[model samples]
Target: MRDPWVRGLRYLKGNLFSCPPQEALAHCISEDCRMGAGIAVLFKKQFGGVSDLKAQNKKTGDCAVLRRHNRFVYYLITKKKASQKPTYESLKQSLVAMKTHCWENSVASISIPRIGCGLDRLSWEKVSVIIEEVFRDSNIRITVYSL
Candidate 1:
């Protein structure tokens, strides 16, 4: 089997929504489903499923999913509330949850921004390693995007 691959754009570039519709999109959000700032604001404006996501009742370190046509949007619950910052541990747990969802659903590719590193203020170096570690054994390909 081919090894899973994770690569990022050389610089902050590209729109996460620009990826092909077949690919899944993921980003970090609080358990409360408040996507009020940063790239999350754009995600909220584009997807608009706050009620559906809150209905899932996911806790921090879980993954909440929203299905759109043939694609899935993954909301990684890295923190308890939007007002609080996220920890690396919670972010890793959320990634593991997301990875499991990808495996179960046969989602081969996913596009994500530097999760937990934007408004959440976690270090990219640490977050990237956590992401790579969580998905290393899977066949899914991860595309890290920026704006």
Candidate 2:
């Protein structure tokens, strides 16, 4: 087995929608499934699975997954409501749940933005560390994109 690799682009300079067709896409959202702000709006518009994600009844520390075509879309529930803020603990739990889904389904790569650092106001430095720590033992390649 090999160590998992996580890469961040200094400038990222990529589109979330343009990631390789085979790679999975992930982003943070609230448990209420209201993706009315931030990069989440794009995710909702692109995937359009509001009812399906809500049907899962995911909580603040859970991950809601949507299988579209040949890839997966991971929705990390980091807060109880769209108006509420998310804690690092909840973020970490969501990531772990997403990782479990990835491992179970043999997903090898993910394309994501600087999750939780935009409108959510999380420190990128802290969030990045948590992401690394959670996936350290898996071979899944994580690509963190920034604008």
Candidate 3:
């Protein structure tokens, strides 16, 4: 039998899946970015100076900041709606912004908490499909934090 998790990836059970503890995430990739698999790496974020977990960045970092949910590494992921859908160029631009930050900090890996879904009201199933397909094959390591 083979281990289901992609190499280097670990599954956190118990609190990890429920009220995951605060951890860091890496650079953000935009809607139309070329994602890498097997070759991916996820770097964690360091504290940027927030008094509380719910605190927002007073200023965007030269690199990306880590997201947290209930004191856990987290973010709500979702897909673009038809009404406010984005163009490839715009998506690419957004991704570029994130990449710039990654480059600035020399980040090689990243962790993500479902991006753009939940309460944001993006369909969970759809989000899963989009991210999987978008990041089908690349050198970038992305760890999807389960909550």
Best by TM-score: 2
After aligning candidate 2 to the native by TM-score, how far in Å is the CA of 140 from where it should be?
A: 0.6
Number of the top lDDT candidate: 2
Q: Itemize residue pairs with steric clashes in candidate 2.
A: none
Lowest summed lDDT window (length 10), candidate 3:
32-41
- lDDT-wise, the better of 2 and 3 is 2
User: Candidate 1 lDDT, tens digit per residue, 3-83?
Assistant: 344353222358878987999999999989989999889888998999999999999999999998699999999889899
Model 3, 2-101: lDDT tens digits are 5335544433332223322333353232222212221111312233322332243211111223434522222211123322333333333433444454
Tens-digit lDDT track of model 2 for 1-147: 443444432224578788789999999999999999989999988889999999999999999999997999999999999999999999999999999999999999898998999999999889988988898898888887766
Badly placed stretches (over 4 Å) of model 3 are 1-96, 132-137
TM-score of predicted model 2?
0.92
Tell me which of candidates 1 and 3 scores higher on TM-score: 1
The residue-level lDDT of candidate 2 at 66 comes to: 97
Instruction: Give the alpha-carbon lDDT of every model.
Output: 0.86, 0.89, 0.36
